[model samples]
Target: MLRIPTLCALLTLTPLASALELKPLALYQSGYPEGTEIVSVQVSSMRVIVSNSAQGQVDILQLDPAKGLNRIARHSLVAEGMGEITSAIFHPSDDLFAVCIRNSDGLKNGRVEFRAAADGKLLNTVEIGIWPDSLAFSPKGDFVVVANEGEGYVRDGEGFRSDEGSISLIDLRAGVAAAKHSLITLPDLAGVEGATQAEHKRLVERMIDGEELKIPFGTSPEHIEPEYVTFSPDGTRAYVSLQENNAIAVVDVLQGKLDKVFGLGTVRHAADILDDGQYAPTAELFALREPDALAVSADGRYLISADEGDTDPKIAKTKAGLPSGGGRTVSVFDAVSGQLLGDTGSQLDDMAAQAGVYPDARSPNKGSEPEGVVSFDAFGKRLAVATLERADALALIDLDQPAQLKVVQVVGAGEGAGSGKLAPEGLAHVEHNGRHFLVTGLEKSGNVALFELLK
Candidate 1:
């Protein structure tokens, strides 16, 4: 078990409404550099795989009921020129796992490597689109989808340039050896079946407005970066987060095409738009729900998003001289229609403040930056676990009543870095041997903290 000197910070917080509690079990140190980030994590049976992005490697660990988590193997560079590991996910039924790796030069396309979960041995290597940032497997374990972000960069002289942001659909029906990779390029907004002309116009007006883009990049089809991906229950559809554009792309996995692109419009709510020491909801601003992580309900009826806010700072200066088009809450939307259902208005930020874990420094920006989210069934209740990157805490929201959503618990991870920031990036929920666990990767602290769900 790891020492939690900071857990007492939440003792004075309000009581949780539900019986669910995250009991801290132990912390597994990555044994890497001090600033090395443990961003992505996934568990299968007794095995766990974590991504060490700064070091460009994936560390495999084994969970023992008698002991704790122990490092089993470390793997890196399935092929030369591969960059940092972006994300990793284990197969539902097989002893296999997939990882998204970007190009070292950041100019070429990336690849997804399938490896064995037992020993982290490379099984298959399939090249995908540029900058594959996130990965997801179909429910039935027949297919794996990669969200190729295709991030843009600026040179010394030339302006910003980017690769076409696309999605990669890998067919693993025959197995990883026979994987068939296909890239689904995002069509223009006008060509998308589910995209509305009015939504497109509003987005352009908010970001461009027929003038030179105040931001660094344009919100064109090629520049629409895919951040995270979640699949439908039946494995027929996939939802991809278009973070910078403040939209979501629905991909038809079977047909292997970009079906639709619908924008997640702005959310006007009470928030703290200043970095002052006072934590007050003094401003009512219209924030663009630039969702970073997404999760679809098991019934495929509701799509939930953790809006971390990726709006450009330059654009915020133009918007009433305040940080308006930013994300700081989780939102719920109708899965099929892409209609807004309900969102936690200022609840997340408020809860963090009350719990004494809110990052007051981030108030002027996206406070509490809820970056990673995962929905799972545990303790006879449907719950969504959202990681607050800036606050170094986890918000557990009850999803049984989607419309009447309640934040049941807000638990702090542990002691943060020397700068008082843990920066929890990726989250994974696993049920093994009759017990459920929430494994979180703390990026700045270089540790994977395990929490056992208990009544």
Candidate 2:
């Protein structure tokens, strides 16, 4: 049963304008044990798919805002030595959904498992590249594209061994079971025509404590790892977020190869970089916009990213010697030219502080890490919703004026008992019965929260 927490508090950042309003509906707990990470939540016309990656299980729920939410079915794949379940997405126009699983060894090839949305029956398993981090369907639903992260791993006495990251194009024209994939490998940054390394040096070297420190922009082709993938409105091209490399890869879908790769550069802002049980933007730092998620506007004019910061060991080590790290902002870019248009700066962190949910423990690291992001149309406005992993809140941003971005509202996880909406990971918005609903999978709390958008 869906239950609303009496202790939850709704913090409205901007005045209730003629914009979208988020009302807390209910929290549906999975009843899983502690550490059961609900990393992904997606809503379809039929049901809601909640991925508990920690336990290798997926829970299917029925979210009827007019009534209540209920779990209809559950699927588990918790055997030893198998790939870890990363994410799941429903087919655009079919009764099917696919789940990405990273190989347990992390260096071997990962696989994607497609299942029927009706009864959660196995459809087919397709092998892809190493560490399939995220996947998406084309605009026409004719193909399923997977971002093969291929992250580097350090073995005992062997030092670091890196894998070449690539994109896997899964053709679904024949059918789901007959689907086959082809790999699209990335080219050297210097080899891509019209691409230059100078643009990526926005924060290549910074002065700290009277010494200049150099940061890695992932200039090498092997250092590239695709974190998230998004398609254009026309499906002619796909935009991928290279988080640790602080870059983006443009893939030509028709040609089945990488078109171009460009860096996201860096951002300068004042942030709270200490875990002293206090929250204040007292330190100024220059950090990379190592975006973790990518979202394109409906019109295909803009590309949005949640600058979650770098996770690469080299980048993290360099940042450790500095003042701060992490993007802590949502950046907007030109979809066609890959140009940085605008960003939210520190507004996301400010909103969390204002709501009294700022995670001081993460201040010394990536403050309120902005991870998952999704864009959609509602209330006669173009908007983007971002998940603040550490803050346990959602940042609702207005993209109407992309350059002058605004945090219209901050839907925070209420405080006190029975409000375990922590570390929101996956997000999906849908309109049902003429009402708009936003669903989020709470990673740490093992719960799913549903919010209704009111006019």
Best model number under lDDT: 1
Error of 1 at 436 (Å): 2.2
lDDT of 1 by residue, 40-140 (tens): 33444567777777776777777765567788878764444447788887788788788888887555889898988776788999999998889898988
> After superposition, which runs of candidate 1 have C-alpha atoms over 4 Å from their true positions?
1-16, 34-44, 78-82, 154-158, 190-215, 314-316, 321-323, 417-420
> Against the hidden true structure, what lDDT does model 2 obtain?
0.73
Worst 10 residues of 1 by lDDT: 200-209
Clashing residue pairs in candidate 2 are: none
Task: Give lDDT per model, in order.
Answer: 0.75, 0.73
Per-structure clash totals for the candidates: 0, 0
TM-score of 1: 0.87
